[model samples]
Target: MSEQQGRQRVDVTLSINGKSYTRHVEPRRLLADFIRHDVGMKATHIGCEHGVCGVCTVRIDGRTARSCLHFAVALQGHEIETVEGLSADGRLERLQQAFHEEHALQCGFCTPAVLLTAEEFLAENPSPSDSDIRAALSNNLCRCTGYTNIVKAIARASGREGEAASSGTGDAS
Candidate 1:
């Protein structure tokens, strides 16, 4: 524990996107806040904060987890991957390209989480059915474009776009 301005802080070294970030933070600081404020990455948005919205999703050790549900101090020495890390050099990843071509996002508030989730899901099940995709994305909520295009994007990324064509309501509901 380190003391700063009469406050006790914990120093944690987190590996994010293949880089190491060491910072002194309060013991109770959430990982989402630390990523957004300390590390200065804005892609990890905070939504419901209750682990229900899935807006703050990120890959912890190659598994998708809610950043808002974790504390920075508890994740010391852990591997964290955000949407910013999804791309290499200047080119977007295949899933991101699919999202772009499929017009999967609107308002763009929840796109990052959805992309991260879909990335992990596709890795685990490359040939997922439409219902499997929907079940995987059920935790993430979107207020626009229904879920038609988003599902299509994931399916396209998985080389199975044809299967998702008939699924989804395309309605906000």
Candidate 2:
């Protein structure tokens, strides 16, 4: 560890959004801060730094994790994906488009985490029921939209809206 700006700094090289970044960060620096301040990706929001809010969620080595709970040094060789990487082009991905169509966001603070969670969930399940979508989203707190539109958006994105409704799990009740 070397001293930088009065703190112990460690050299780390990590990939973010398909781009490689090498930086000297404090050992205690949160991954969220590293991504936001060091790597300059602002999509990963920091809320309830203790990892309860889930707003700082990102994909670490193909798994969803709370960036706020991990140190940048711990992710030295890891591959992280922020919301900006989800799009192949400069436009919104299907899930993001679904969110927009469903009006799933209000303040938009929780959108990134919610989108990441939905991406992971859909990747594993592909055709998740409404209950499954709700269960996956239960770990995150959203102060807006009441989760009704969010569920619908996920259902729409998964292409299971009718099945979810037929199963009586997508009513938002």
Candidate whose lDDT is highest: 1
Model 1 clashing-pair count: 0
Count: clashes, candidate 2? 0
Q: How well is each residue in 1-173 modelled by candidate 2, as lDDT tens digits?
A: 33445686778888888889889876788899989999888889999999998899999998999999998888867889988888755434888888888788999999999888889998999887777788898878888777878898888988756344344343333
Off by over 4 Å in 1: 1-6, 89-92, 171-173
Clashing pairs in 2: none
Task: Report every candidate's CA lDDT.
Answer: 0.85, 0.83
Off by over 4 Å in 2: 1-6, 89-92, 162-173
Q: What is candidate 1's lDDT per residue for 58-159, written digit by digit as tens?
A: 999889999999998888778999989887453347888898999999899999899888888988999987778888899998877688898888889888
Error of 1 at 134 (Å): 0.3
Using alpha carbons, what is the TM-score of model 2? Answer: 0.87
